[model samples]
Target: MAVVLEVDSVDDPRIDDFRDLKAADRRPDRPGGKGLVIAEGTVVVRRMLDSPFRPHALLGVDKRWQDLAPELAAVEVPFYRASAEVMAEVVGFHLNRGVLAVAHRPPERDFDEVVADATTVAVLEGVNDHENLGSMFRNAAGLGVDAILFGDRCADPLYRRSVRVSMGHALRVPFARVPDWPGGLGLLRRRGFQVVALTPDPMAPTLATALTGDRVALLLGAEGPGLTEEAMTAADVGARIPMSAGTDSLNVATAAAMAFYERVRAS
Candidate 1:
């Protein structure tokens, strides 16, 4: 069982881990980070406890702590109680989430293990926006996609902004970075996953027609550049989402949502 701590001063040394929340992500001495995985709100903090990331300590307002009593019932960590002003002082801003949990990031899963059971997966290349990555995971979780694969040049999924943007879904989704660039795509084909490259090219077949396979893996690229020719040709087929003419292509995450929608619709 965890102890409830009464903290009156913002300078309390016991709550040091919760201090300097902005610089906490930097790894000045540790291997992966000094930046422990910090969950800002009640939802994300709950997710951190449920995910591979385990919280060492919690800092929050009293009401927030009371609200989290059930989730923290068996947790052996200290809940550092503070006022809204102190939390704002420590976190460098007023956190509307009212609660924060800090956890160490777990190891990354291997590529083979990540793809083993996925029937529908989204593969990303150079899709480096943290928000996009977060939205993609949320869409995948809600829309029934099995997994996500980072092809290359993707953003850090565990980044603070990404985690918050994902609404805690990033922690639930399983992902692994692909080893080789375009060549690693062959690995999916070998696993019986029909790899389809999503493109904006009107010449390509519609996504509804292109995504016909027992196991489907959709390849996506960054918004402006789209998929590289090398990445596109590497896949078995190129699929296009039918959109109204003259307007720009959908945002990468939105496009991924549409594809995930198609998968759910098919099932």
Candidate 2:
């Protein structure tokens, strides 16, 4: 069982991992960063505890600790209990979520291993927004998408904001980086996945008609630029979600949700 330690002082060195979160050591993508995966709020913290990213410590208000007590019974880490005021002082802001957990990132999953049993997956390119990535993972989890594969210029899915926005689905849903950009997509193709690129172009076939494979990989790009021409060329087909005549495109995450729903609807 985990140990409960009372933290009355904001300067306590024991809770340093929960302090000054804006510092470089907290940002996994920045220089000299510790690459720690931070889960905020009771819900996300619970998900982190259940995920492969094992949390080493947790800091939260008494109420939040009580809410999480059942789940923490099997956990071995220290649970630092503090007042909301002291938590705010230590973390450098008022955190309404009332809880935080920190874990070291596990080794990245292998591309082949992630896709080995996946019947449906989403491949991303240049989708840099952390919120969008989070929403994408949440949508994938809810809609039965098997895994997510990253292409070129994509944001780190384990980033703190991404994990929080995902409601912790970023930790639950399996994902791996696809090497060599569009070229790496060939691995999916060779594995018998029909790569379908989502686009705004009206000339392309609708998703309903374009998706015909037993195994499918949907390719999506950044919001403004959409998929690069090279990525489109690599796909087996280009498909579009029907939209109102005036709108040129949808938000990347929204578009991804629609495509994911299509896959579920078909299955």
Candidate 3:
């Protein structure tokens, strides 16, 4: 059973964890730039509470507290109740989600641990956009990607925006960072994973033919740049989505979704 403390003033220091959400440097969630895993809205918050990332505190209006009563009964945490106006003042914006849960970032999972027992995985490179990273997690979860492996220079999937965009899927899907860039791809290959690089090259083999392996690892890159030459070289084969001629390349997340769908279809 959680404690519901009614807060009439936004200046209450007890709710500091929910303060100045938009302030890049000062936001409690963004402590030292690596923000806490923040779950906004009832759905995402419920997912977070159900996930391994445990919430330390929550802030929202009375109605949201009532709405989350069933879920709240299972956790022993503090719920800071505030009006929409006070919440907007404290968080630095009008958050229509009406509720927020803040959790400390959990330890990163080991690459081998993340991929062990997985048949399908999504490997990412240079994907710095938060929204794209979130969407990728959502797609991976939806289309049966077992885990997400990060290569180099990827965005923080635990960021608030990413969590919201992912509809809490990021919290549910397991992800890990590969120690080395292209060099680390050998780990997957050694594990019998057919590392397939996704590219825009029309000459490359179609996903249907390229993804034939007992275990498949789909490598995706940023939208404009796609995969690097080194990354492509590291893969066992290059795969394309078979788009119409003259059309631009798909967004990285969208491209990954198509490949994920193809993987499911073929299985």
Q: What RMSD value applies to candidate 3?
A: 1.2
Error of 1 at 146 (Å): 1.7
What tens digits encode model 2's per-residue C-alpha lDDT throughout 54-148?
Answer: 99999999998899999999999999999999999998889999999998877889998999999999999999998999999999999999999
- Per-residue lDDT over 1-267 for candidate 1, one digit per residue giving the tens place of the 0 to 100 score: 767898888888877766765554542112355646667788888887788777888999999898899989978899999999998887777888899887777778999998998999999999899899999988999998888898878988877777888888888899898889989999999999999998888999998898889899999999999888899899999989999999999999999998888888946
Q: Taking the tens digit of each residue's C-alpha lDDT, what string does model 3 give over 110-147?
A: 99899999999999999999999999999998999999
C-alpha lDDT score of every prediction, in listed order: 0.85, 0.90, 0.91
Candidate 2 regions exceeding 4 Å error are: 23-32
Q: What total of clashing residue pairs does each candidate reach?
A: 2, 0, 0
- Candidates arranged by lDDT, highest first: 3, 2, 1
Model 2 residue 148 CA deviation (Å) reads 0.6
TM-score of each: 0.93, 0.96, 0.97
lDDT of 2 at 224: 97
Q: Clash number for model 1? A: 2
lDDT of 1: 0.85
RMSD (CA, angstroms), candidate 1: 2.2
Better by lDDT, candidate 2 or 1: 2
lDDT of residue 124 for candidate 3: 95
